[model samples]
Target: MSSSSLTVQGLAKRYGEFVALAPTSLDVPAGEFLTLLGPSGSGKTTLLSLIAGLASPDEGAVRIGGADVTYRPPYERDLGMVFQNYALFPHMTIEDNIAFPLKMRKVGTAEAKARAAEALEMVRLPHVAKRFPRELSGGQQQRIALARCLVYRPSIILMDEPLGALDKKLREQMQLEIKRIHRELATTIIYVTHDQEEAMTMSDRICLMNAGQIEQLGAPGDLYFRPRTVFVADFLGESNLLPARVTAATGDTLDITLAGDAGTAQAIASGAVLAAGAQVTVMVRPQNVVVRSAVEGSGKLKGKLADVMVTGSLTKLYLDALAPGLPQLVAAYPTRSLSDEHRIGDLLELDWQAADAVAIADAKGH
Candidate 1:
């Protein structure tokens, strides 16, 4: 199947007084899997609707493979869409359901049958070709829906919460299956979901939206490790956001004094320019935090161990920061690395490497 590049230039949408999407521009290379991810009302679905031609944009252009498709209808966009409900005909056989799109396109009977079978094989559900949709499990039905979409070989595929209805295990299984098919076909896909983990697992790049606008756009690691805004940091994953005042800039690192008497620490600024007196938030991932009875030097955050949880391979420690006005901090470690020393009510020292922490300006705090 041939893939096509997608470009949205200055796309904007509004519902009377409320803005559904701000002026947004993005370039998706052919075969790149990009996810529109965010919380509800963050414009992810709105963006997907506009791209699929289900809704018209108030302003902007949509181009597929460099061709202007702003005014084109959904049918002419050459895109396939998969929904959470697995929109398959209940009465039709799985093979006939997969071939339905080809029938509409007036493909030859033998060719459609062969392509339908091939699509079923791609999704690893060829054995159920003769079964009705009701006879298959939820996961198998979803695979059949995907096969139906692929039988016609649309240039782009848009999936909106395709696995939202499945259980955790089944959802994970479907994620891998869809990724496998994507890898095999190299088709351009624009997926929309509120699940950060799902986006991280499946997307080549993620476009995070918030408050009807794009908050960040980058690889999962880039958004997780080096977020440009506090919302991105807090929304993407668990983070320890410490309020601090910048004390000085030391090369690429910045010396910051934590709020209250939490002492001072150095953090990599990651190119954020700030003055000495600038208020900022230092973000540290829980996995990067080191918990020990004693940290060698000063600048350690002392806290009482509020709780400890051992979950299979990982042990989580919750600590109440000794500093006034500071929120509780959480630290995660490998279960094998911890002994019986961690207990509730015990005072522990928390520390992390300067490189593992990021100092972000607090002006845009959420």
Candidate 2:
């Protein structure tokens, strides 16, 4: 299948006083698997709808392969959309459902049948072509829906939570299947999902949306490891957002004092300029934190261990008040490495390397 690049220049939408989508600009390279990820009502679906021409934008434009299509209807945009509820024809055989698109385009009967067969093969469901939609399971039906979309060979394919209706196991199974198909066909895909793990597993890049605007756009690792905003850090994964004050700035590193006497920690400045007394939040992942028996020095954060829970592969340790006024903190270790000597109410010290922490500006808390 052929693919083309997609670009959205200042695209936006609205409903009365509620801004469904803020003026947003995004460029998706050709053959890129891009996922629009966010919580509900974060403009991910709105953005996808605008790109698919399902909704007209209040301003800006949508371009496919550099061609203007902002005002075009959904069908004229050369895009295929797969929805959550596998929209298949119950009365039609699976082959006919896959071939229906080609029929509408007036392809010859022979060619439509050939393409339908080939599409079913692509989705690994060649044996089920003769079966009706009702005879197939949900996962099987969703595969048929995907086959129908692929048979058309549209320039771009948009998936709006196509796996939302599937069970967790089936959804995960389909995620891998979709990634394989994407690799095989090299089709440019713009997928929308509210599932964080789904976005992380499937996309070449993730465009994280919040409050009708794009919060962060980057590879999953970048967004997870070095987020530019607190919201990005908090939304993408579990993060320890410790309020702190910048004590000093030295090149790309910042020495900060944690609030509530939780001790000082050095963190990457991330190119942001801050003075000696600027308020910021230090973001640290739980896996990065190392907990040990409390020591005599004030170099590490001191807390009382509150709980220890094991979650198969990892053991999570919860601490109460790094100091008298700090919020709770959490640290995780491999379940196999957890020490049995540590007990609840034990005094503990938490520390992490400076490189594992990042200090972000205290803005955009909403």
**lDDT (Cα atoms) of all candidates against the true structure:** 0.91, 0.90
Per candidate, the number of residue pairs that clash is 0, 0
For every model shown, what is its TM-score relative to the native structure? Answer: 0.97, 0.96
Per-residue alpha-carbon lDDT of candidate 2 for residues 147-232, written as tens digits (9 for 90 to 100) = 99999899899999999999999999999999999999999999999999999999999999999999999999988888888888
Error of 2 at 123 (Å): 1.0
Query: Where is model 2 poorest over a 10-residue stretch in terms of lDDT?
Result: 269-278
Instruction: Mark the regions of model 1 whose C-alpha exceeds 4 Å error after superposition.
Output: 294-297, 337-339, 364-366
Residue 249, candidate 2: Cα error in Å is 1.6
Best prediction by TM-score: 1
lDDT of 2 at 349: 90
Please list the residue runs of candidate 2 whose C-alpha ends up more than 4 Å from where it truly belongs after superposition. Answer: 337-339, 364-366
Per-residue accuracy of model 1 over 34-70 as CA lDDT, tens digit each:
9999999999999999999999999999999999999
**How many Å off is the CA of 82 in candidate 1?**
0.6
Residue 171 lDDT (model 1) = 93
